[model samples]
Target: MKKKITLSILISEILNLISAPLAHAASLSDVYLPGKALGGSGATIGGFVTPLIQNLALLMTGLTFIILLLSGFKYITSHGNPKGTQQAKDMLTYSLVGLVLSIAAYWITKLAFVAAGLDFLF
Candidate 1:
């Protein structure tokens, strides 16, 4: 019972610290400035960068998916032709590379921001 009470007190304090920011946000702006959400507060630059990155990410991902789907269709339609099959495989492989690179870039950027002490995006 004593241990439980102590744990509860600690947890409550943590919750208060975390939520104290909520009591002060002027807007739900982090949705826009994910990468710029530093200073422990939201800013206009962050708000803009967040949505821009999100939209570009979505666009790139969608394009990659579309490429993969089209490549699958080509491979399927190639039937038994070795040449057509090879081309389709290359397309799929290139698309995979693009996807991997995009994801890596995102992580690298996050690490860079962290190393710069720019505050981790929320």
Candidate 2:
């Protein structure tokens, strides 16, 4: 009972933290600079692309975590087989590499946008 209550409280706290940013999120009108036209690429494209890249990075990171879990499970169930153990090790390495690449992609997207003179994130 104690563990359940503690776990529930922790989960709720995490949810609140995750949702806090979204709760104070900018409205569509806020996406545009005061003098910029709504339909212009500066507002529309930047707003769309920044979030899309961020979300994609987040998704890839989550999938990498799932892959890590699968790799661990495979290792545990490998039953001393050399090939299976090697496969699990390879999976773990590949998943870590993928996670790193995903994070890099997110940063690269930001840099590319800034280099293109969009500077939308700021």
Candidate 3:
């Protein structure tokens, strides 16, 4: 059924988001932000900001998913009502836009660092 397909897709997306952080966790910890040299530890910007960016992406993804869920719920509860359906659709659209913007921001930040010639694995 359509509902089943939607539910499965949502689950797949949730799984993807959950696994994302784990995938890049190693790189995050290895970041060495540049700062005042401490003893023998080389002064590195606060090191790398990949963790922050990753965490932010995760947060935004979660929020977008929540929005999508809420919109779906609204659509279901509307029971053929036109205005409510429209509202739900609008929410879905906005959430998708937000997700895209978050992704863009993440990449832009990374691009900025790259443009500056800073060497850090993203």
Candidate 4:
């Protein structure tokens, strides 16, 4: 029951983070204007795709952060058990690696778009 409650809280937190950007919008039209949201001129391929890529990167980063937190929790709760401790350490390492890779990927993608002359969208 405690685990269930913790999981639910984590899920709700994630959902809230994802939706926080939209909460400030006054209308559906504001939410629909991705280009404007990103400070671009208007609707274009870059306007659409850039935000999509950014959002995906943000989501991945958030997931990695959550994984790191869980791994720490596991490590603390392992009580010196070698197997459980190892698993937690592995999870922590993997989450850090994933976070780095996702950030690099996001930068690489942005650079690619800029190279392709889509600087205005980014």
Of the two candidates 2 and 3, the one with more favorable lDDT, higher being better, is 2
Per-model TM values vs. the true structure = 0.59, 0.63, 0.63, 0.63
C-alpha lDDT of all candidate models, in order:
0.78, 0.82, 0.81, 0.85
Quote the lDDT for 122 in model 4. Answer: 48
Candidate 3's TM-score reads: 0.63
Best by lDDT: 4
Per-residue lDDT of candidate 2, residues 22-52 (tens digit)? 6467566655563243333444578767777
Error of 1 at 41 (Å): 13
User: How does residue 88 of candidate 3 score in lDDT?
Assistant: 97
Which residue runs does candidate 3 get wrong by more than 4 Å?
1-43, 46-48
List model 4 lDDT by residue over 1-122, tens digit each. Answer: 99999999999999999888766754666555555765657576776788899889889988998999999999999999999999999999999999999999988988888888775354
The list of candidate 1 runs beyond 4 A from truth reads 1-44
lDDT per residue for candidate 1 within 27-57, as digits (tens), equals 5565555424454543555455656666766
The regions of model 2 sitting more than 4 angstroms off are: 1-42
Number of residue pairs clashing in candidate 2, backbone atoms closer than 3 angstroms, sequence gap of 3 or more or interchain? 0
Q: Write one digit per residue (lDDT tens) for candidate 3, span 1-122.
A: 99999999999999999988755554433445322222235434525476767888999999999999999999999999999999999999999999999999988888888898875465
Evaluated against the true structure, the overall lDDT of model 4 is 0.85
